[model samples]
Target: MKLRLILSFFLFTTCFTAFGQEKKNAVIVEKGLIKVSVMYPYAEGKTFNMEYYETKHMPMVAGFLGANLVKYTIEKGIASGIPNQPLPFMAIGTFYVKSLSDYQAAIAPNRDGIRADFSNYTNITPVILVSEVIK
Candidate 1:
């Protein structure tokens, strides 16, 4: 009876542990999907308003992209891999879309308005990269 009790407890623990270790469902993007990355390189005396970016800027951009925008992510730099080293980018905004041409068409009419709103947030001239998601 003692051996049976110990074995049951061990089995229960092992099952619980296995269930707890299950991996999270990750976002999956197809290989040919378009990825647009906007990076703001870090600089001394440069300013970034994370609040405005999150609340106003990104939403506005996403709205402009409309149905063409699959999904998006915003990242704020906090630390460098090397201790005491300056972080590379102040912030990064990336969006995934099905077609690059569709994204361009959606943004064309709103480009002027989008550019105009930049001053409401930061002074950084954002670096833009358009690429295909290979992974």
Candidate 2:
């Protein structure tokens, strides 16, 4: 019984150690392959249109550009806040492209289509940015 228990514990420890090592090796966040950023803007009188853009326009835009909408952050702006005050409604999107020029060209022509889709909003505008993951 003691030998059996020891063997079981050894197997469990081996499996756990292997899984932990795999997780460390498999994580690609710090490999400088992924891109990330925030899109900042304001949303005061354009709640409905903003929601429409969040749900409809962005998905269509992503589909058109072959990109992915990673996340969306909506916050109220502060008058006396820091120099880089966050926008009220920002749709953060990230695209994993091997090259920056390719990413730019991918969404170059879709600008007109995206503009037409969100033409109803006068105040709503997207300020897109990207950053590479650093090791």
Candidate 3:
């Protein structure tokens, strides 16, 4: 239920801001890879431990998922497009996979263990975004 809501919100946001005056066909096509974004948003009084996320958490992710993960990119959000403005997210970690099945297969079995490790780094809940890359 919660995940569905989050995914729905992500979808809406992506469609709204994905391109600047570009048409649908120009932005997205049928054939592309699956991309997942794990976003940790910033709060007024909250903090994000970038060191732990990079050094410990992501390594564990790579270890458990192994070959299923095609590639990954980690972003530490700095600010909005407006200069000196704070970013909405603290960090965003993205993972790539060949297919939805591959993502499901790799994550389902290790969900609990992976989730448990969140306490080692962050207190804020993360938003997850799953999308197909544009061709």
Candidate 4:
């Protein structure tokens, strides 16, 4: 049992080092309870409306989500880590929230409106994930 625990700890540390985790202060750690990432993948002959996504969609999301949204950041992808490589995603929107329940409750009432507005952004289906913060 002791050996297994030590092995698990070693693996976790190795993975953390490989991923290059950012060092954080206590305040930042407490602020991040959960993370939601929405990724718009790149595809040949596809279009994405940066203006609509940033200006219109995000505003609507803020209204619907309100206090549930602790903080959010949107990033426009330029290139991948590989030299002279195309980016896998056109854009990524990350949301930090306190809990899964809060996110779900916020989505429940505004799910239809959010879904309907998707057509205004891009044709490609977005990839989304909700992750609990390890710290």
Residue-level lDDT of model 1, residues 1-135, one tens digit each, is 999999999999999877666533456677998999999999999999999999999999998788778889999999888999999899999999999999999988999999899999899999999999998
Q: Clashes in each model (backbone N, CA, C under 3 Å)?
A: 0, 0, 0, 0
Clashing pairs in 2: none
Q: How far is candidate 2 from the true structure (C-alpha RMSD, Å)?
A: 6.5
Cα lDDT tens digits, model 3, 1-135, are 999999999998897777544664352324577888999988887778899999999878877667767777789988887887777899999887777886788789999998998988888899999998886
Error of 4 at 34 (Å): 0.9
Candidate lDDT scores, in order, read 0.91, 0.56, 0.83, 0.83
Best by lDDT: 1
TM-scores for the candidates = 0.80, 0.49, 0.72, 0.73
lDDT of 4 at 21: 50
Least accurate 10 contiguous residues by lDDT in model 3: 21-30
C-alpha RMSD for every candidate: 3.7, 6.5, 16.1, 11.0
Show pairs that collide, candidate 3.
Answer: none
What residue pairs are clashing in model 4? Answer: none
Reference-based lDDT, residue 45, model 4: 82
